[model samples]
Target chain A: MASVVGEEVSNKQVIFKDYFTGFPKESDMYLTTSTIKLKVPEGSNGVLLKNLYLSCDPVMRILMQRVVPKGFSNYTPGSPINGYGVAKVLDSGHPDFKAGDLVWGSARWEEYSLITATEGLRKITHSDVPLSYYTGLLGMPGMTAYAGFHEVCSPKKGEYVFVSAASGAVGQLVGQFAKLLGCYVVGSAGSKEKVDLLKNKFGFDDAFNYKEEHDLDAALKRYFPEGIDIYFENVGGETLDAVLLNMRDHGRIAVCGMISQYNLDQPEGVKNLMCLIYKRIHMTGFTVRDYYHLYPKFLDTVLPYIKEGKIAYVEDIAEGPESGPAALVGLFSGRNIGKQVVVIARE
Target chain B: MASVVGEEVSNKQVIFKDYFTGFPKESDMYLTTSTIKLKVPEGSNGVLLKNLYLSCDPVMRILMQRVVPKGFSNYTPGSPINGYGVAKVLDSGHPDFKAGDLVWGSARWEEYSLITATEGLRKITHSDVPLSYYTGLLGMPGMTAYAGFHEVCSPKKGEYVFVSAASGAVGQLVGQFAKLLGCYVVGSAGSKEKVDLLKNKFGFDDAFNYKEEHDLDAALKRYFPEGIDIYFENVGGETLDAVLLNMRDHGRIAVCGMISQYNLDQPEGVKNLMCLIYKRIHMTGFTVRDYYHLYPKFLDTVLPYIKEGKIAYVEDIAEGPESGPAALVGLFSGRNIGKQVVVIARE
Candidate 1:
């Protein structure tokens, strides 16, 4: 077997075949090998990176489809699909980076990339934990759960918390964090396995498989008779409307994502927003990147809990880059039990 | 006909007509003229009030419709409508209130009302300002705009502010307050007169009549090519959808009311909520009842501005109780230019 080394070498890259119309299929991406000189070009400020592991997020599904007003740049047809990933430095002309250093941040989904190391990249120093942990529990997903719960929800002790998509990367941490804060947490997942994991592994107060429930409103009422105080919203549409009816006075909703509505031609209408007026609820949507400055503080808070076994994390790692297409597509179908991570190589 | 001086006597009162359907027409209400004795019952702990001024708010329109699962009480048929109003104390058994004292808070729309001197009501000490002002500017509407802008929106100097329903009670004050904070303020109103008031009276940097605009998104883009930093939302539906497209990164929206959707069978679905995820925007809905504790602080902040004529106020006062039905109904149709008040009698 040939290995990639310091030479004028060829790097295999994955590129989007064309703009996806609906749900992204495996055929939409094709891997192509190309050669490039290993030396950094003169007067250029870019870093040559050898990609290790790439994070497959549900949001990437929306980025593949056509959305109006062009929110974030969608994957360009016949070009590299960019996302967050971990990489090793190969060659550097940027002032902040050097060769052989490990870094984890936003990068393109390819075997190798020459990136400008803009505001997105951060050098990974501590390897006490698996580097893959940054892709799931300690990176964007972790910060998302942390900031949405602490900053947006502003939860108090003994509050009743409800999480949707409860077994995913962010929802799992949100449930655990709420439990640590002395809250009574209930979560909803798609499958029985995920529901059991919520109750047994993550130590949620209660959990249910939303697929089995005939009426979501009744399910929510059964779980929260007194009504929910904080709702960590990941799935929008009917679930949001049902939760709106079940929210207690002064309830707060931290909207992290709306996975259910992302791929639809038209999103579902919410009929119960008038509840916000009578109940005086606060519904806020936030992105994890806005809270990056709190990364060190988040590590200080979550790491101790992790070491003491007070916090538990789960991941569904796909073995190789060839399976990346399947792993990313599985997110829309709720196939991954926890965080969906694509493993390129074992270090 | 003679005026009854501070004499203790039984008086006729009006009661709410049943829950309304579709648009609330005048016939939905009934002035029953039932008599309530001007005296607190023996061993009772409530105050008997002479209702002077009644506020007609948009929320009352929602209460008149059918109830949902998270339902609240609607006005019973053959009964009077209820809302926040100003009244004079006729008799009192509650220790916190005294006879002949002035008070302002949530009260029923009637000639006489017996209310418990609970936490919702406040004894009015400063009566030098027009007593009717409590029905609009210095009352629940005032506190709503104050808290929604200062607390929720968190405006900073030089930020661009956009207020919908800008000449209505809350939006008018929000635009002025944003301007006073050194923000560049723009407003959308239904009528040209309101647009003029927004720019001239409220000191808004720019104003537009949304009714005249062919496209709401284009109107927003024309007024704010760089995008709005803060949006004080009153009319929801398309306005909210348009504002979402024109929001700058990290914009804040204070959702005080959604008058446009109150009468609709099903509220319009918002398509651009995903913008919040990408732009890191914050949208929060609040009620004045949650922020009444800031009344004294509000008085401190607003009184000086009012005295110095730095803050301008407009009112649409109806002469008698007969006009109350039309005045309240007019809010939905955008007939009233400013605060809508129904005056039963002048003190």
Candidate 2:
């Protein structure tokens, strides 16, 4: 595989500049040029990948912050940024993958990435669908929604499901999945456009623009008259507090992410947690990494929905590696309405 | 069953004069004498009870306040304050109960209570144990501890357990139960006296006085150097926030009560909840009432421990029904050392 070396070419990469405190800005990361051998080093046990599509997620903000929380690693200042991405294998020293194999997993944000940690990479078996779907609908975010909804929320037919940031990457899929399970799904988003997308396009039973609602509790009560049984929590803070008050007995809250609290120096104080006791609510937080074992099952369940046109996905794609900083930062300000993706190259 | 009858007698009752806010005072309740015929109505099915022991629990404060939370009914004004109590059935029109039967369930804080809702009542089977034990060790609080620690927390042998307000009725039992499962148990109490009782009497592995510790997170870190496997949340607010930070991956938090938040106008906001997402923690809140259906199973498991002196119960007995208000209020101020019980009549 090392024999396919081309002439020395400049490989563009996004570098983490410094540790961030509050909200991360575009300047927090800078572009740099580097040279790659275009091949896996001799006797090296790793895969050489040509990056195609990069995923811009909220967890990136936490990785950019000064002190990373426990069980999570921070991006090094001088190194290239790493995230979930779609890539084509150019060279492979590992037996599982070979050249020309398109895969999705953790990768460095550069034209070419030498992935030493290649165990998480999944080989693309179905090419009939758009390859970029591996970065979202078939990738980390996909598995997240699949596992978070089915295993975490433990949804039952006709149960009331409420999702926050419902038009975002993971939340949108959760709403659709809940609807498919025969749940009465309601979603809350920041804008009318997102809310409309949730109801009209994604098949949510109802949707509301949280920004317009002065009283979140009242808005929730209006949407969920009997109270919510399953809450797919993507945005935390005020939304979480309100949901706590409106959850039904034996309710389940799958805390997938707290996108609202990531940029803040101090996360908002949730005041209605006592409601958890009275309602006998179960709230759990999880990461997609732990659920990758179900990736095969997830694909089997979700692939038919995609091929049959039963599931709809919206991606806000930015072209070229130069657009990486803006594409990532736009997530914090809700500048991107749906799943934020950055395309580096085509096949 | 309504055969017993007696001449009219002046029944001493504690009546709720007004709805309370913030902290309840003795003035919120006043003594009233009412004449009773000491017999059930000829056509109606209700029990006439002579109250023996009343359990003063923290949740009573929430019921006494103006606004009741969902899933919990509030005590009405101009009515006797009701709580879990042990009583002697003077007369019963229900087929399940009869005159001279000993029962414990929802009963009024008065000398004589005409119990219309007797479905929650459990007839005493084990007369060998002290009858007052029904209010603390063998009744609501006992079932609360058993179900909370076993069913909700799912304690495994050699696991690390943390109990907040550990010398109180439910907390004391939780610590002992955790120890019985061969888990390493630590407890936090308000006073050094209670702390000592947790370690020396309740068989806790370690105990700390939360009042003496300025930083709860630091205190928790010192006690749980490795991490907490399960947290029995009897006291919420800051303790909950700290426990969130120190929890191990997949830790369980059984929220039985939030005594610290019951008296506050606005419950304190929990700030470190993001740990839940990072550690993949599970936090659930429940009540003993929901688990009461397992009462026979619980008694079968816990009764032998009591008989063998493996479980110790400490009670702060208020001499008479006149001491009810002070005994109940003392819980918020940390006056009572253990389970607060008001004795009405012995036997």
Candidate 3:
């Protein structure tokens, strides 16, 4: 490929139009095109990235709301929204990154982004796996499952583990990780296909379609007869209330995200929280950003599993930058089967 | 005192008439008498106790309900309800206890109790402090404050600590313990008197009457401008929901008790729990029984403070065995200003 120096290329970007209160729609964000110089600015330690794959995460919904929840920064209206993504370094003024280096971390949902904050950017060393995996299974969601389960839930062999939103990005990996740890893992998804994927593809001991279950408490009782020792909470609300009653003594709940409640104007009230005292349960919330220091150790542990075909990943890819809004909005409606990703440019 | 072995004496007792729902009343229990030989039966390890001071705890109310919560054994109807008390060993078949040894542990709400389950009993080593303190400051509540604060909350020096129900048995001590660790401690109580006790007696940095504060979230923000580093949760419901919003990143909540929700048929829904994830908080529920192994170490630390007047304990004493029902029921209504105790017989 010939270098196109000082040339302006049309950069399509997703922009936040307005803050949302309840469920977000495609109109909440607008797609706009502008031209960008495909080169780093002079004398700046910034990396110019041609965004390849953008991750559509549930936490982005929280950032889109008018009042950003505590400990989170909101996306500015009219500015390009940024999230975890895989990008190729088109130009670099930074010491670590150079041209042609494939990197992933935080990137704008646009064709090109001049990233001044490149401290957290991880340089991709291996391309044996799909590059898109850097946006899901090998990226933030994977680390979330790894850290939330091992560090927060503290699973022991033969312990009963239950995960909500089990077919989603983090839940799928958590169920698999729990199974690998010799735990009895059960997962709950919204659709039958996702449920089947959980039990069949992810090797979960059991899986249920939560949408079909009218009585969540009874469903939990049927699955976790002895009681759940670890609950990887991804979809909070009634599921949490049911799981509370079914938790064993000293049960651990690793609250990764509450996707079910994210878009609701008022999140459902958890009524059985008193069970936390009765059962001596520990409920902790965590983020992958805190566990980034252990990325190498995490890779060492998970990479072998991937190579051995012991670990499986499922991705729901949206074809182009134009599909970004619908793909991101699809998460709140439980429309995505697995990890939702928007592909801007394959290279 | 002479031993009256063969004589049948009237053993006045507070008997649970039936299981209760919602708030328990004094009428739920009735006074009765039964003849006892006042001697330990042959070939039995049961220790006979002359009940001196009975500790009125919120947990007893749970045991009195028809459906008992998990991890706790229910008190039987038509039987003497048992609780923690200071007692004198009248007759003992157990090796550790002898006649006239002052002890504090599980005892029936009666003048005399035949304790078959004496394993949890602790022989009182210090009579220099008030024997009544055994039921509150020196017994279960003291150990609860010690373990829940240091072990569960993991307090750091100069941390901003908030305690709910701060004039109550465990809360009073938790506030003091946080202060001893060089933390700035604020406390909330239901009454102005209790609030005064928290600030004037317990030495809390600040105290508020939660009853007067219509907006709990605003009150918390007023107290914790920067954010709360630790919350010693004794009262749950609205206070918990408010504190969740005021917590700093990685703040811990040691759930020692939820006195506010114990009597409710349906516990209050904590709406702001999503804040747990937003702030990466750790909310853990703990009971003192699990930390009893550290009792001796706890005493070594707390006893000095009590003896030196560094720790002040307030007790609301109900005179005689006849007053047992009212003192026990007073806990639910927040009528008792401090540690509620019924003095059966001082011996």
Candidate 4:
């Protein structure tokens, strides 16, 4: 068979079964092979993407739950589940993208995806870094950590910063960013290995394993004796409640995600919110979509740090889409260390 | 004894007996008549106050709690209960306050009090408003409403604003401010009469009795189909949880007080805090102390409104210091309408 611009090709896709109840499992999604034409649809300004690397994020669980968050669409059943990914444009009807152009944005868990929403998609300009970095450090997660830390939290020098889920995709960079900005940073992770990575590798002032602590408030007091000035909230629920108690006066909490609460049929109740008044805390929730305009500035700041080895990122990469479901489900159980990713095709 | 520089005067006081459990009742405090000097002491920069009007606030319950919030001290036993009040400076050893000065600030619930902490004291300027107004509409609660509505909530024209505990001192002003700024204001009170006061007297576009509604979320949905843009949170716990679900994207919640949770041994779990993330909501807890710098500006904005009949104020005046305990305790039971104030003397 000769290669053609508009020829049919085999597309292996992960299909979401349905909106789930308490916790999601690998069985919630199934893989299937389908045929797709290697071209954009007629009269549509869409781009044909051959997805290379897909990100396994905690937010996908929220989109999969019964009620999808505002500003995000639900993953319809019998359709390919989608998230941020690295891809090559095989064909384009949009002016900004063309054949062979490398890009990263919203992509389906399939071999090929025709993305009609072209605005969210951005062409990958710098090739010196690994293309897979677009799925973690240089893409949505990176932007999330950047905007959440610098813009939302409005951190100042020598502030006491605490990051929950500190060894994961966004938290690791937030700790690093706070440290770079002359802040005293502490992090909490589930495993000892991740804790060690946060303290030694990520330059956190101190790190603790949250799983070992029965009293989160006491653990936080041990780490942040003077109380936390900034909290980069990743895993919510009980952690958030404890963080509220330990927050300093006028503390700022940049809420990026709540992985712990995502799987619950009823999200855990947070009781210490009264501290927000006593401490004058500003707890704000935000998404990367609102901060995409800062991408250029983020790249300028982060690319240098990455090149100079000032920033370190770790990826737990699974080989293929067959491993995607387990890898995604494992996030709830703390199975993946650092940023979780699955490669559909490395190219 | 005849009036002299340091003559002793009989001072009737409301003394807090002890920090007791459950709801604050009249028995938690008792009346005691003690002798006090009518003059400020030598070598001390204290002002001798003749407390005329005392404000009964929900925060007094918090100060009486086992864990007093930071920046606030617990009420020591056998001492007169202190809160924001209107007082006359009978004698002063400080230059800022002189003898016969009319002032309003932190005052003890006694006929005479030597206020050593005189920095918080402010000499009443515009006497055109009722002297009793210093305890409610033009005093600390007024400043609280002003700073909270203008600075914290950051409202805009045509925005949908909701005020909880709407018939109370702070909530009433907040609703009026939102309405005066051309915003659609809805209020939730504990009683039907208070609800009527909010809608008819306070100029709220809509009002609801929170106790009457079985489902607060459904109640809010009925009033605000477009969702709340700003929530002036005076009553917390379940009401806050309900408001979280009914908030629009990027909504702001100015947490003025948590009257509902103050007496609870364990605050109710707010399950919908994740709504903060889903809606990109900004929920901030604040005390009037942080915004005291805006008092002069607030006076400039609000004084004329009070004078011109643009802002309506309602007070549930409980006459005499003997009535203080019941008036203050009645706040928890929602027995008092509007601002609950205790008048010690008219002149």
Candidate number achieving the greatest DockQ relative to the actual structure: 2
List where candidate 4 sits over 4 angstroms from the true fold. Answer: A1-7, A41-44, B1-7
Per-model B-chain TM-score: 0.95, 0.97, 0.97, 0.97
Clashing residue pairs in candidate 3 (N, C-alpha, C atoms within 3 angstroms): none
Where model 3 places Cα greater than 4 Å from the true spot, the runs are: A1-3, B1-3
> Candidate 4 — which pairs collide?
none
Q: How many Å off is the CA of A15 in candidate 4? A: 1.3
Among incorrect, acceptable, medium and high, the docking class of model 1 is acceptable
Query: Candidate 2 on B115-217: residue-level lDDT in tens?
Result: 8888868899997998999999899999999999999998899999999999999999999999999999999989989998998999999999999999999
DockQ of each: 0.46, 0.87, 0.75, 0.85
Cα lDDT for residue B84, candidate 4: 87
**lDDT of prediction 4:** 0.90
lDDT of 3 by residue, B1-347 (tens): 35465456789999998987888899999999887778899988989888899999989999988788766788889999988999998899999999989999988998888889998699999998899999999999999999999999989999999999889988899999999999999999889899999989989999999989999999999999999999999889888999999999999999988888888888888888888888899999888989999999998998999888889999999998789999889998899888999998877
Considering TM-score, where higher is better, how would the candidates rank from best to worst? 3, 2, 4, 1
Which tens-of-lDDT digit does each residue in A233-339 have in candidate 1? Answer: 99998899899989998899998999998777767767777677667788887888678999999989988888899989999998767788888889989999999
Candidate number that wins on TM-score, 1 or 4: 4
lDDT of 4 by residue, B222-310 (tens): 99999999999999999999999999999999999999998888888999988888789999989999888888898898888988999
